[model samples]
Target chain A: MVDVNMTLEMVQASQVGMKAIGAGIAVGLTGIGAGVAEMAIGSAAVGATAENKDVFGLVLLLTVIPETIVIFGLVVGLLLLF
Target chain B: MLKPEQMSRLLIVASKDQMAPVVTELYRHNLFHIEDYVEAGAEGYEGFKIGSPLPGATEASGDLVKIRAIENAFSIRSEDFEVKQRRKQSGLQVLIEHELPAIEQEVEGLTVNRSKLETKLKEYEQKIAELTPFTGIPGDLDLYRGYSRLVVFAGYVEKEVSLSVPHEMFFSKGKGRHFTVVIAAVEQRSVVEGALQEAGYQAVPIPDESGVPQERISFYSSQITLIKKEIEDINQKLDAIKEKHADFLVACEEILKVQVDQTEAPLRFATTNETFVAEGWVPTNRVDAVSDSLTNVTGGKIFITVLPIDLEHDVVPVEYDNPSFAKPTQMLMDVYSRPKYAELDPTLILSIMFPLFFGLILGDVGYGLLLLGMCLVLRKYLKVDDGAQLLTVLRNASFSSILFGLLYSEFLGFELPWKPIMFSRHLKIGGGEAGGQGPAIPELMMLAIWIGILHITLGRILGMINHARQDHGDHRIKAVMANFGWLAVMWGLLIVIWTIAALPLMPDLTSLPKIFINLNAAAIVGAVLLVTGVILIARDSALEIVELPTIISHVLSYARIVAVGLSSVAIAMVVNFIAIGMLISPQLEHITVVGVLFIIMGVVVFLIGHALNMALGILGGGLHSIRLHYVEFFTKFYKGGGKKYSPFGYKRRFTED
Candidate 1:
């Protein structure tokens, strides 16, 4: 009976460990995806800003548009954690 | 507050003789945005051609150019000086005619003297550098030049040379090189040149002076110093002249500029042999005032016509009609695009929403106060045109941040004495404290989502209004219905989520009154609305069906407000723990040399870490807040490509009529 109880406890611990790994993957991969997307946009935004400074605010908004993907991932990660 | 100032098309017709007075009166009013007449394409006015500038235009422009040159010579910018009072135009004109030539001659003489002295100083310095290397040789400076039968080669060499034929050589090491002077007969010049080439010789031009090399260097150095003194004196005289005439010269410039503008006004007009026509835009409210002024100026002989506004063909210029407080927000709108004359102006709404979002993202009392102080200091000192306006926007944002900081009970990520009135953003994941309250993360996220719902709904409503006001026939109705469809779909989804998910901080919709008999009326209603919304959207355009997921994603996008804030708090907490708890507090338990050293290091780390976190907080907070509005809110309804209204008159700073 003690052995069975120990196995059950191990299972619960592994479940929590798995949840942690899942949450990490969710946020980490999405962060990488967002970074990749932002690379092209950031360069283009900078080029546009160099030519006309009035577009600075608009370009800044454009450069960070991909970051919304990371926010979604973060929300999902929080859901899994809590 | 939601629209630009109303503009009316103005047509002013006057005889050629009254043109001067009409132009002067229009400039004094400062209310006209002139549209230059195009001679080529104007219909029903083939006789009308672009008018020539008035008689005195050339002379006024010439004077204006001279004044600008004078200002440039003194490096004088009007912004650098405070005009204590406006100078009278008549006094300025007299100064220009009587005193300007004398002042110009005095200034010109000093400038010429200074430049000549500078050039002389440069020549003396060059002579000194040239003669210093020759000082290594024991010889007079004149001995190296004006030889009758001998040729001399004096320069730096890699190795000393031994001449084959008759030659006198002097060699010394100086200035990081081997200096050599070889004097040989004219007949052996080729042999000496060959020897010098083998020794890796490079020539230095000999100076034509009569003294010993060291004496000559000293003589040039003295001359350089004397010339420098003369230049300094000339500069002082020029500075005095600048101080005495700065206000007068600036006023002269202003009067000359106005004179030139008045003379050139006819260039933008359409004219025939006897009369001229000026077409321009005037603010609708100022029409009567401007007409009366023109009538009075021309002795009631001027012909004025108010043309009907043509929304279909005319590209009306936009001038923001916001209050003084909302003026700075116009800078933000300008960064995106000015609103078209027919479109709704979003500056007032942005002024309110921008600061609120900024405060939401960077809610910390210490950071907020620091930002506020920085804005105040910079706005006082930095005099750039846009910087002061930007600082005002930031100042408003900082105030909002302080308010939110109180709500969050946060001062630089540390908990305040009072319990958080809203909710705690302090995470309880570490430090081994049991029953430590985890951050109200779910509640914060819920709040962000609710904000997203309301903001997006407002945008759709505005979109509906915008389309409804446009004259797109059936397309306008479709656009309005499409906005309604999106709203319906969003609310339906919200209802469905409320019924399906037991989310924190959400109202329990099941407890509300039911319309159906025990069949989940909320679910049925939600499904019906969703389907109806989808069908309506499809009717507008099939392409819009592909964008259906955007509705969900846009709502989820607001989660960043919480996410970005939490990350900032996490960084602050980590910095505090590492600097104070791990480094300083641990070392402070015992007093020793090593302990003191560690404590000092901890203090450095704390300062640097917090400084970095504060910078990141501001940049991230400001960018993200503005991003939300520009990306999510603006894309919904804003289509901003409008011409800016610029009146054809200068705002005088130095001179008055």
Candidate 2:
């Protein structure tokens, strides 16, 4: 019974470790995806802002639109961890 | 308050004699948004042409030009100066007719004199530099010139040269070289050139001068000083004139600007040889007052008519008519686009929701108070119209943040004396396992999701109303149904999740009566609603069925509220830990010199760390909150390419008619 309990504990610990790794990958890869999506948008927003200052708020909104991808990833990661 | 002010299309036809009175009456009302008459020759108006300026326009324009020049010289901007009392129109007319020309003449003379003196000073300075290299050599400048038979090379040489031909050489030390003057026979040009090349000689042009180099430099220096003094005197005179006449000149400019505008008003009108026609938009409520005043001024001889609006063709200018409290949010609306005349204005919604989202993300009392103080100071000192409005928006956000801070029981990432009335944002997974105190990660995430669901649903409702109200004809019903379909999908998904996940604050589906063998009432209802929503959406546009997953992503996107807040709390906690725990607290056990030094270091780290975190919180909180509104909420209903209403009259600042 002692050996069986040890084996059960080992399996549980490895499962926790694997879940942690999965959570990290979910958040990390999505963060990269968001950054790549924002790269083109951020530059275009800045360029438009330079020509006309009145578009500042609109450009800012456009610049952060892709960041929602990362937010979704965060929700997924939290779901996995907890 | 939700809709823009209604506009009426106004048309006025008047004989040539009544044109002046019509223009004056329109300016007095200051409510006319004129549409410039284009030369398209549409329908029966082939003979109509754009009118030339009135009789006095040329003189008024010329006077305006002179006043602007003087204002430029004094560096005076109308907005920069405050008038204690408005100047009377009669007094300004006297200043413009008699005193303006004299002032203009005096200012022009002084500027011209100053520029000439400046040019002379530059010439003298250049001459002084040319004479500087010659000063090292001790001969009179006359010796280097006026020698027909002698060839003089007056410049620097690398080394001493023993000329093969008979020659006379004078050498003196200069900057990094020997300043040498060699007078050799002109007939021995080849031999002298070869000898000078061997010595690495560089040639300098002899000046056409007949005096000592030292005396000439002194002469040019004194002349430069004289010219500089004369220039200074001219500038002082100009400054004195500016100080005395600044008020009069600014008032004159304002009067002339109004005159020019009035005189040039006809340029935008369409006219024939005997009569003129002007068309524009005015607020519906003010149409009666404008018509009565114009008729009263023109003795009822002019023809005034309200043209019928064509929804398909007529271009109406949009003007926002909001309450005083919501006026500042118009700037934010303008940053995106103004609402069309027929569409609902979202400024009121933005005014409330924007601050709430900002507060949710940055719920810290200390940061809130700091931002509040900054906004107040800026609003007080900044006189710019747009800047003041922006500061008011920020001030509102700051107040919201303070309210949320009270709820969260947070002061700069630290817990307050009392327990948080709401869930603590600093908690992560297994937070309840440690102390069973505040809410854990799942609860906070669920709260953000709920907010998203409600917010998105509100957006869909607004979208339905917008589609119905707009002139969509037969397709209006379908458009509204599409919006309803989106709403149904969102709520259906939420209901399904509530039954499956058993999350907090969600209804217990098990407690309700079961409708089927294995399913409860809520589950069967949710599945039916989901299927119905899908069918409704497909009925509108078959392709839009592919965008169904987008609703889920949109709802999940609100999870950023918790994620961002937690990241900020984490940073503040790390900063405090590193500054106090690692640096200061360990050394506090002993009051040695090293301990005192470490304490000071820790204090520096603490201040810098909090400052950085505060800036990041403001930027992140403000941008993300506005993004939720503009990107997610507005995309549902807002279709904004409205023409901005610009009236024809000026708000007189310096002179009043």
Candidate 3:
């Protein structure tokens, strides 16, 4: 097996930063995607919940389901760096 | 039980002699939800018209309408003043006999007087403006009005135009603010008008009055003062009437309403001169008690029959009977839908599962306490009635969150000092605290997938039970197979994923050949079950293929359960990092002016940052869990188009039976 110090020296600091950068982009873009999906769903959800209080829980659920996109991105991001 | 309470139709027949006693007894029992029987298609009975209202209903309705009008005229608000404790029959009789007629007359007089005063006040105000401009005129307005030949243009003009107009025209200085002037008939009247137009002349329309401008000014000024006093007097009278009758007017309207409803009760039945018949629905479990009570009340003279027959096509009212602890979960189902009479009620399952997911996302003790405290404050101190359902959901969610908080050993993104009831969140996976390590991201993803597996399986199980409940003959094999197939395919997918993710664990899997073979076997198992479930659900069409991608996405959706919690913790940790940075800032090395400024800024940042994090935590944690139920969980088993139960009985306020 190669020495741990030698292996660490072989990897460039900039290349390590690049992985971190990729993870950030993955998370950031997913955030924008989640926000867009929430905007469209949220408007209808709010209107329905206003008409009847009963629809509030369902509306809240529908409004946040798109959040999974960001979580997927977070997983991808975490995998990249860690 | 995960189903609405069972119900059956009821019919009661009472002779004219027993109708009063029967109606009274039914009112006391509060059992029937009356179905108004209109003889729309009774072929033999064209003479059987809908039942008419009992005696005095007309009078009661008239009194009610009058009370309403008085209340409106007086602008009476029920909550404006304290009302009498309860509205008794005697109280209503006294109000109708003594107070209503007097209140009606007084309100009428006050309204007429107020309107007259209002009109006079407007007239006086208009005259005051008109006469003020004319007061400076040398001659009376009447003197100007009598002119037959004079080209009288009397109005204000701009400063520039007043100078340029013909000198022979009446040049007396009027109100200088606008340079008011009267252009009498000049020799060149046309040319003069052209000059006036160029000068921006605004002609004042003269009112037909008998007196001079100065006299009229004084006359209007005095008139306005008198009218102001009169209007004030009218206002005072109306206010006094309101003060005296505000409470009484509110009570009077309520009494008349109850009287009207009681008198109009017979209109729901089919009545002949000799007999009355009415139909309604009652909960099956309470039918024996209701029947017994009605018989005893009417001395068994009137027949009360419980019809046990079931009509599958008829729309039946649905009544939910959830235990008190599970009532909040019913609020979630109510917003989505009311279950059909024959389908399952998902509230109890929802109660257990919804908060579990919520608490999983929260996973922080400090924020849980904050949320719980906020809900308690809102529910107890605020006493707001609207959105009580939402508040109940928040309270339940926070309770679960506190439970999870202890398990995760997190206190506002900080690790607890003592032993946790379970593992810490920091040990789970991914970034959370400022300086903490965790298991691989893949591990968390797997946990999310497992949760999805269980949630979806439970949904299918419930769906299977719902179908079985509605089935009459031997269990409908196709429906059962479809539900059973869903369960099989989900498990198949779960095992396949678990097997692949754990492939490296097979003791130095330098043997790539064995890994490939294991994956192949798992894939085959998943594929065969998937196809079987598809065939069961969609035997006639290729449309079933569309659900495969949906199934995959639905499982992935559970990833949010982990994702939202991670973000919430990240935000909290970030806030703490910033706050601590300020407290121990490098700028604080010499205690300079800038250092003190930075400390203050940091304190503000810390408070605002944590406050924002806590708010988002509640929304993200509470809502995402609820989403798992409605979107991922409920579609599996629930069919919701049940008619809501609204009994034909008044909810009395300020009255009791």
Candidate 4:
């Protein structure tokens, strides 16, 4: 009793929903990924600090580059929302 | 290929007493000056030295002279041979007499030339400063900031004028018109008044304290050309002088080298203790010769002993100790020195596995090939020390990726018109093929599992051999039983299971019945053998209960390979689905902006998603690889952490020279 022509529309709609969820998950997980990445950079920063106190800016810049992943995910989520 | 193993014992001695005599002897041979001193109330005296040789002191004549001094001063006389510390004083005297005047003359000449060049440069700069106002307005005005005061000179007429403003400021009212303002600064009043009079403005010059406003960077224009000319002249003079005196400088350097050598050599010999007592590190292979040399020098009075030290895990609490950071640093050190011991020699296993997993998670043949090509080109042109080794491993993995690409039937996640050389037998690619027309997915999975099994088996075998070698008889029994006995039991069980499965599926096949019967008998025999092996192994251990769990855990750790491989494939599939779905969507208008956007989005998603997947895969795969080596493989044969041999030498940063 299923309408064959309407199946394609149903599938597309489901895809849109799935994509929205995927975007959210991607954004949420990106924060976790950023934290994971910062663990290594933070350790390296501590190591650098042993040698020089003036490297805080450089370390902060490097550590933030990875955080761009979360920003990218956020941008995608915003697009989905709109 | 045979794996390289570390030597059992390190030849380097760490004791301070043991190190002193060797250092003293090397110093004596190299003609290094040593100083000995005693604190007023201390029971023991201390000696120190500038031990390393100066540059260009390794010539035959210099070495011969130092050797002769050592033989005459220290070898012949067992009595205390205190260095005649007055040699430095005598050397200084000689320097003043023979070389000081020439050096002073050269320095004076250089100073005179520099002064003359500086004066000429200043004159040229002044001329350029005067000419700066004549040049047309230079470059864009947006680059400059701060208050700009214009003193416009209009000759013969006063008129309403409009000035062109930047296009960005077109919205502002009255910004295009030139406006007149009264000046306040006293220094600028005369200049403003003169300009206004020249321009035929209303003839009133205001005498005020505030100067006329002008452009901030106006002074720099005139000096630019003259400054350049002066710099060029000075450079030319310097070039001429450098060319003329190049050989003279070389000769002076040689003379200094000889003088330092002569002075330091005799002092080196005289300072060394007559009855030498010293200890220091030597390469493991050179330990015998070092010990023999010590015996010859001190007539067997020196005691020499070598101890094994682990370089990998042993943390020396020196000035740079930070426990949190040390773990990764030690891992890096292990990677740097004797890298093969971590996995395979050259870490080929890690190298191959990482990129393969990366490419798998990436799942785009085009990108994979691009990366492969880039890595290859870098490996070829760059002068990296590890380039060749890393390239060989990557080249192999790239080939593996190409193979996997064929199997996945993906080229940048696009289906090909031609038949794929390899294809997944489980999931029909593009839903075209139904039955088995390609390589079986289960077969590939089985191959991966088999490889994992082989690797773990190798680890166990190594562990057994190392135990046997380290402890002769009964102590090795457990290792042997844990490896071989378990393998035998597992194989026996598998044979029986295979037979049972085959009996119903292939009743007509005579081979199945024979295999089934034989395997069933083998399983019973294998069980008895396993029990006997375990009992023998358990005999030496105090607590059988503890050893059982350890053995079981080690065996089970082999499952990580399958887990990692499955994760790689799953991630790849997801990326492929997203990429293909974007490209093939019918809603996007073909050949239009929407269509182009879809294509671009697809490409971006493919690249970004796969790249992330690759990075994650590498982390997981690399850690798992290292774990397999450290816990499973090295637990068998390796007792790392040996001290590396470091000789007294110059530290080269850029090049060997």
Model 4 has a DockQ score of 0.06
- DockQ, per model, reads 0.50, 0.52, 0.33, 0.06
By TM-score, the best candidate is: 1
Give lDDT for model 4: 0.45
Clashing pairs in 1: none
**On residues B536-652, what C-alpha lDDT tens digit does candidate 3 reach at each position?**
766423565566655777887887777788778777767766766536365667888878888888888878987898899888887778777887888787768678876665555
- List the candidates' TM-scores in order: 0.89, 0.87, 0.81, 0.44
TM value for model 3: 0.81
Candidate number achieving the greatest DockQ relative to the actual structure: 2
Q: Which residue pairs collide, candidate 3?
A: A54-B335
Candidate with more favorable, higher DockQ: 3 or 4? 3
Q: Kindly list the per-residue Cα lDDT of model 2 for residues B1-657, writing each as its tens digit.
A: 888989999999999789998998898788999889888986667999888887889998899999899889879888778786788999789878999999999999999888888888888887777788788778899888776788888777888888878998888875667878888888987898888888888987777677999999999898988888898899899899988998888888888888789889998999999999999999999999999999999999899999999866877899998888788989889988888888889999999998998898888898899999999988878888988998898899999999998888878767777777888765432233212254467878889888888888888999999989984766888889888988887787777766666787666565666668767778787888888888888888989999898798788888888888777766776667668777888899988998999999999988899899989988989877877888778878887778999888888888776
The 10-residue segment of model 2 chain B with minimum total lDDT is B427-436
Candidate 2, B465: how far from true, in Å?
Answer: 0.9
Candidate ordering by TM-score (highest first)? 1, 2, 3, 4
Q: For candidate 1, write residues B1-657 as lDDT tens digits.
A: 889999999999999999989998889888899988988868766889888998989988998888888888899987767787898898788888889889888888888888888888888888888888888788677787787899999888898688769889999976556989999999999999999999889998888788898987787888888888888888888888898899888888889989999899899999999999998999999999999999999999989999998887888889999988889989888888899899999899999998998888888898899999999999888787778889999999999999999998888777777777787788753382211366888899999998898989999898899888864888888888988998999998888777766777876666556566643677678878888888878888879999888898888898888888888878877777777777888888877899999899889987888788889988988877777888889878888888999888889998887
Q: What does the lDDT read for residue B5 in candidate 4?
A: 32
Q: For residues B1-657, could you state the per-residue lDDT of candidate 4 as single tens digits?
A: 223333223222222333344543443333111222222332322453323332344553453443333333223221222222223334444544455455445545654665776776675555444333322223232322233553322112243423232111111112332223332244465655654455344422222112221232344344555556665765565556445433333333334434454334333321233332222334445557656665565555565676555444432211111233122223322442332232223233434444454334334465458557866787756554455545544555556566666656655445445554543422333343221243344444444434545655665566565555545455456656655654544444444444445432222222333334354444455456656545554554435434454443444344444445445545654666666554635435557777777778877877787777665654565455545555554544445433333233322121111
**Model 2 DockQ vs. reference:** 0.52
Q: State each model's CA lDDT, in order.
A: 0.86, 0.84, 0.73, 0.45
The predicted structure with the larger TM-score, 2 or 4, is 2
1 against 3, candidate with superior TM-score: 1
Residue B255 C-alpha lDDT in model 4: 41
